[model samples]
Every structure is written in structure tokens, then in C-alpha cells.
Target: MMIKQVFAILAVFLLFVFPSASLKNLTYQETDKVALNVSASDPDKDAFSIRYGSPLDGNGQWQTAYGDAGVYRLNITVSDGDLSDSEEVRLIINRKEEPPMVTSLKPSTDALSVTEGRMLSFSIAATDLNKDAPRLCLVPGRPERFWGEGFFLRSRLR
Candidate 1:
């Protein structure tokens, strides 16, 4: 009886102290799938998985598909897989794109202006969604690492 009691106490202690630690809630951005830039994050996550459910067409869960674009309910699940504690997040899949780019980059007529007692600030305007998002090289004749992105352009005045 004494041995059993001791074991029970240890078990209880472990259950309380080192319980199967895991994440609980996961969430998706509302702007996700709106511009087709769905992103997700989990607080105590260990792994990630995307399970595609039936679309408006009422088909089976789509784990993988191609060229299919519409309103689709996506069930994104993240799990520790050790404690069975996982989270599910819904995603509304929508694909967005711009027209083809067949033109070259245009040069800014405005030259670099450096002023004393003031910062040399300038704005850039571009049409490419990916390039103008501060990721691509914004400034002309500037280092690739020195570029800032904006909604319609990247603001890098160097």
C-alpha cells in the first residue's frame, strides 16, 4: 500500500509538473485568401498541416489540387503530436494575381538629393506586387540589401 501510494504521488506530480505540453489555439489572418496571401501562426506549436475541406462545389477534402481557385474552407491543424493537444484554424482560399509583366523597369527622373540638417527622403512607385513590397530592389544603383517596401512601392532613398 505504501509503495502504491508513493507511485501515485509521483505520477500525480509528473502529471502536474511535466504534463504533455502542447499548444492550444491557432489563428489565421483575415486578410488571408483575400489577397491570396494566407498566413498562420501558433503559440505553442510543434508541427503544421493543411487539410483542405469541401469547396462551394461540395466535393471531398482537397489535400492537393492544381488550377482550382474559389472560395474553399481550409482546415489548418497544428499539433505537438505527443500529447494529442492540437489546434485547427480555418482558411478561406482565394487566389489573386496581376497581369503579365512584359515591360522593363523605368528609371526615376528625380535625381538623388542630399540636404544638410535634413534627411534625403524620396518615394518610389512600381507596379509589380512582389517587387514593390520592399522585398525587391527598389532604389537604382543601390545595394540589394538596402530596400524598403510599401503598398504600391518600396521606399528606399539612398
Candidate 2:
């Protein structure tokens, strides 16, 4: 009789002592910092451990997401010593966008004497925070006459 009662209690424990875990997907920028709040519950109302990683070893924390730009799969596991459950989320880090910056511009000649067939040179220094390529062009005359390097008419400027 005691054995039968023990088996019944064991079956109840097996049916109701498992744990459940859940996580939320997140998005971030390369230079962004964030924190995560994890959720877990056990049917037995037992104290569980929260884990974030593959194999769910319960070791992870939110901090900064700098220099790491890509998609990352994160796993969270909740364990109650006897039973365990797991959840997963995707964290996407997008590249940051920044406008191009011009630091300095210097002319090759301090005094300009323009004549026919005379070539003028200018030194330009610029940088793009997003590491994007930048181009330089010289525009002359009226605003309507402004054109890019390939389309600019040197003869008109002369």
C-alpha cells in the first residue's frame, strides 16, 4: 500500500514539476548598449536558474554591443535540478550610419594667377565615420553650371 502511494506521488511529481522558459527577440545597433530581462517559471514553484548560451549552462549578461555587427542566436534555459526547459531568441546588430565629414581643404598655391592652359590644384581632407568612400569635385560659375568631375567643362571655367 505504501509502495502504491509512493508511485502515485512520483507520477504527480513527474507530471507537474517541469520548468518552462521563454525569451524575446531583440535588435541593436553596432554602437548601442542594452540589457535583457529573462523570464522563467516552474510548475513546482521551485527556485530555477536562468542560463543564456548554447548547451544552456546559465552564463550570460547584457552589456554593450560595440564592434559586433551581425546576427546572433542566443539560448536561455531554466532548470529546477530535476527538470529543465529552454527558449531561444535572435539578436540582430545593424551597422551604424554616419555622414561624411570634411576636416580640411588646402589650395596648392596661396596666390592664384589664372591663365590659359593653367591647371589649379587643391588638397582636400575628409573622412566618413561609417567608413564609406567619398568623392571630391570642383564646381565653377553659376549654380546651374555646377557639375561633377566627369561632367564639368574645364573650358567654360577658363
Candidate 3:
């Protein structure tokens, strides 16, 4: 009877000490490489097999794919042979914003000032890594065109 009571108390202690698996929330950018390792615990010191569901592809520590830009609900399941548990992790993948590059601006530094009635020529060379070519417009912020006498000339690269 004493041994049974001791075993019950020990079982309760173990239950309190050893908890189930826990997954930490992850946040990453689309350009960054993502590899999330599962954290788990068991009373018997059992080895856990972890796998990710949804956007994350494949199993293993560094073999997961997280390239898409969105909020992904990653359900990671960990199994310790006999017992299995699942945990949900919110994986946020933010899109990478790359600034457009103005390779060269014509009407170079040498010719900075503009004349009154003379023909003024200006050209801009720009490129964007995300898009095929950088968008150009006459206005600084808005997309408007410059019209002359019977000719439409705007701030764009030809």
C-alpha cells in the first residue's frame, strides 16, 4: 500500500514537471531563409519527430521551405513513438521592398542650370530589381505627361 501511494505521488510529480511540446511563434521576411526547429518535452526522455503542415514544405531541421509572403499557420506535429502532440505557430513572412535604382541621370552635373527659351533635353536611366523596368513619369510623385506644341514629351527612358 505504501509503494502504491509513493508511485502515485511520483506520477503526479512527473506529470507536473514534464509538459507537452511547445512551438514558438516565428516571424521572417520573404528574402530570409527560414528553418524552425520544434521544441518538445516528455517524462520518458523520448525522441521527437517533427513535421510542419501548410506553407512549410518537407521535414527536418533545415529542409523546410518558407518563401511565400503571407501569414502562414504552421501546425507542427511532434511524435514520440507512442504519444503524439501538435502545436500551432504563426509564421509571418513579410515581403521585401527593394528601392528603385537610378543608374544615371542625364542633364548631368556639368549642365545643372536650365536656359529660358533654348531646347532643354533631359534623360533618366533607372532600373528595378523586382520589375522588368523602372516606371517613369513627368511629375515627381504622380503619373502625368508633359505636352508641348503638337508633341508629347515626358520624363521616361526610351
Clashing residue pairs in candidate 1 (N, C-alpha, C atoms within 3 angstroms): 134-149
lDDT of 3 at 76: 69
User: TM-score of predicted model 3?
Assistant: 0.45
Sort all candidates by lDDT, best to worst. Answer: 3, 2, 1
Better of 2 and 3 by lDDT: 3
Model 2 residue 155 lDDT score? 22
Which residue pairs in candidate 2 collide? 51-58
Pick the winner on TM-score between candidates 1 and 2. Answer: 2
Measured against the true structure, the TM-scores of the candidates, in listed sequence, are: 0.19, 0.45, 0.45
Better of 1 and 3 by lDDT: 3
Clash totals, every prediction? 1, 1, 0
Which regions of candidate 3 are displaced past 4 Å?
A: 1-24, 45-47, 59-67, 101-134, 137-158
| Per-residue lDDT of model 2, residues 79-130, tens digit only | 7776666666666667776656656655433243446687755566766655
